[model samples]
Target: MLSTYVDLAVGLVLAFLFLSLLVSGINEGLVRLLSIRSKFLWAFLRDTLDGPDRQGRSFLPAGMRDVFTALPFSRDARPRHNSMPSPAVLSPIPEGEAVAEGELTERLYERVREIDHPKAKRTSIATLPPERFALALMEFASAEPNGVQGLLDKLKAMRSPLHGHLQGIWESSAADVNRFRQQVEVWFDAEMRRLTLLYRRYVRWVVAVLGLVLTLVFSMDALEYGKTLLRDQAFREGVAAIAGGGDQGLTALKDRCTATGDSADPYRCVTEALSSPALVKIFDHALVGVAVPQNGDPQVKWNLGAWWERLISPGHWPGFVLTFAALLFGASFWWDILRRLTGIRSRAGR
Candidate 1:
């Protein structure tokens, strides 16, 4: 009995330690996986918006400009130009250049004012500024059938350096984006693989722990069965009777015979002893009871039924409470591990 108690205590301690380690491993794995995924996502977004220039001077639409500015990239270092270059260099007509440039500037300013102040009383010209309207006319002229193909052929032949620069910028940006996306994918795959391995390890640990617990429980039961066999009365008596019944079996039996109170024959005494309630209780209690009392006489009749009743009585509520507490603790620990594993799987899937 003392050994059984010691084994139970050791088993409980080992199980607790095993479960704690399992839970800690699962939590650590999930946390690392999540951290990797977060870093990957942030890096992907940063690469997408910042481009390969890294100087934050990439041309973008107004809305896209706002988005890029919101990212972590540094602002453009060059100052923005608000006006066109001087006209003297644009045209070298000494006599009429000043008057022509002044009239052109005045007309352009007036046209911009008209476009900005359009109303029901405003002049019509598609409500567009003069520069925009002129650009649209130029685009239409460029698309005309008369010389559009010829002009395009000539422009292609020229192969402007600005076009090559823009193309190179675009290609480099695309390659960087592709590289960033690939890196993100690789990171994600690695994290998922790590998490999967962790999950498998956790499952294996749970299985091992469960197997250990079951083995312990069954071993305790087997030990209890062995103890009962050692303390059984009928088994001991059978062995003793077998050893002593060699030659005087019939005479010994006749000498031990007596008149029964319930029946008439002396041989009925043996049958009465066999049918005694005390003998029945001994067998019942030894097989199914909690504790076998170590009385002075090893062959004395044991009250196996009363022992069972005492062990399983409702009055032993403390045992039930302890069992319930252990179950609750185990359940909570299992639930925490399960939740952590599920979260890791879900995140990896994402």
Candidate 2:
């Protein structure tokens, strides 16, 4: 009986891992499709270059705030920024022209804004590396014959927080370009860490919504499945056998699909592996309940009607909550638990 309980626990973990992996795959697709990393990088650049106004709002023109998303991944990136500042904002000053004492910040803002230019057919805000950003800033600041020294002179003359910030980086570099570049890289990394937290917050909400949708769509009632697994020994044992082999099987699939040298689309490869016959069989045996049609019961079809009926039932609320919460813990968490449970089951069987 204790062994049976362990098997039941393994089965539950296996199911949760499966669903969590599915969520992860879908999230990966969304991330790629939306260029989420690029968006966040652009946000970091925008906030850094624009600084803040007296009102504590971004110093960037109000119309250009969402320029981070004003790329292809955004909805109507072109049309949305029709009211943005004109090309003159980003146009570089002619050579040998007199640039203002503290105009480096303004120039930096213009270069960033160029990434969101509406008429530019090839503009893209790709991920900006710290080294590349530092190089660009250094080059932009060296408007006169004096290179690094001229850059430092401009930074010292600035009146904003950026002035103090860059001045500190300059002093720490001992007037060396390479050291300055390294210092800028460190600063960019720190700023990017903040961006990561903001991005994760956005992804957490996205996952919650996606988890709820998938739960209802698939009628994955955790409580009902738990009851089924506890009561049905044959079913429990069958799933536990699969769970015992879970690690090897999943690793093989992940390698063949995602880690292989030949596979072009890793996401599609993962989806195919997950939907393979063996994994499908695991789900088929596990989701057995009223949702499963009786053998030779022609009138009872497992269709949308059945799924919707199961989904809306009030008795499944506890199961729904449990399932949703489990999914939020993610695939890696559940996979670890499944492995531990499998190990325990193996030891117990001996």
Candidate 3:
């Protein structure tokens, strides 16, 4: 009993220690993989862009006034000069109004060059009206062979206008680049969050499984100990005492006399009857048939057998039940703790 108890205590302690170590390891791994500087930086960028502070801000230049002047006009705003000739329409066309397609391209190219220059102003083309520049570029693309590429080359060669329009394009392109970068950051943050959640959940599952394994191991050990205790000679003796002394009581009470035939005295006949083989066989068969019969008084043999059957055999069932319950509870508790640690709850809800 002493050895069994000691073994059980040691096993319990070991199980606890193992569980603690497992949990600690899982937490450390999670932190290493998910908690890093890059993740924080991306998160910061995402939050900054999503905030309302930078809205309606223009990062564009000066001296580019005429470039954006006619941009706000709707596409249909152009006068139909040839639709209906009238006496009122005899006014001479302004030189600026009759500018050729090629001249417009050259002017646009010069403006782009001015905007791109290092000393160019920082103003937004979008703020001035994007339609004019868009329309001009579109008209230039239609009239030129190399599209925007041809226009870019011409703008690069120009000395005047100082790449101002190109600078505007660069600013516009920068905004696009920034916006794209922000999107990438947001996506990265979201993916990290997702992976972190998944890892946490996985850790929880591992903990639960580990705990269950520990419980089963502990319970089995306990059950084996209990079985050993039940089978111990000293324990059996105690149980036997409680069940009452067997066979000897019955033998002491019965007389060895009384026979139906061939006896000189009743005592002798009783003695012979007591020693009869047929009678012994009958009693042995009767004992075997009954579950727990009370025949006059309990004998030592009967007491021992009853004790073994009633006390020892039934103890195994309760032990098994307790062990199974312990394992189940351990598994459940481990799973809950793991879930909280990993941030899996939020992910599950989403």
* TM-score top scorer: 2
Worst 10 residues of 1 by lDDT: 88-97
**TM-score: model 1 vs. ground truth:** 0.17
Tens digit per residue, CA lDDT, model 2, 103-187 = 4434553445434544334224445556666766766555445666665554444333455667788788897877887898888
Best by lDDT: 2
lDDT of 2 at 93: 33
Pairing residues by index, what is the TM-score of model 2? 0.60
Q: lDDT value for candidate 3?
A: 0.36
Comparison by TM-score, 2 against 3, better one: 2
TM-score of each: 0.17, 0.60, 0.21
Per-residue alpha-carbon lDDT of candidate 3 for residues 1-350, written as tens digits (9 for 90 to 100): 66545443444333334444554565456434433222232222222222111353221111123112221221111111222222321221113335332333233333333223232121111111133334434454444455444444444443213134443554555635334334434444564566456444544554555544433333333354443433332333433453486544332223222223343564444344334422122123121322323336544343346433433355545653444444434434545554554435745677
Provide the lowest-lDDT 10-residue window in model 3. Answer: 71-80
Runs in model 3 deviating more than 4 A are: 1-18, 22-175, 220-350
Cα-lDDT of candidate 2: 0.58
Tell me how far the alpha carbon of residue 69 in candidate 1 is from the true structure, in angstroms, after superposition. Answer: 44
lDDT value, candidate 1, whole model: 0.35
Indicate the residue-level lDDT of 129 in model 3: 19
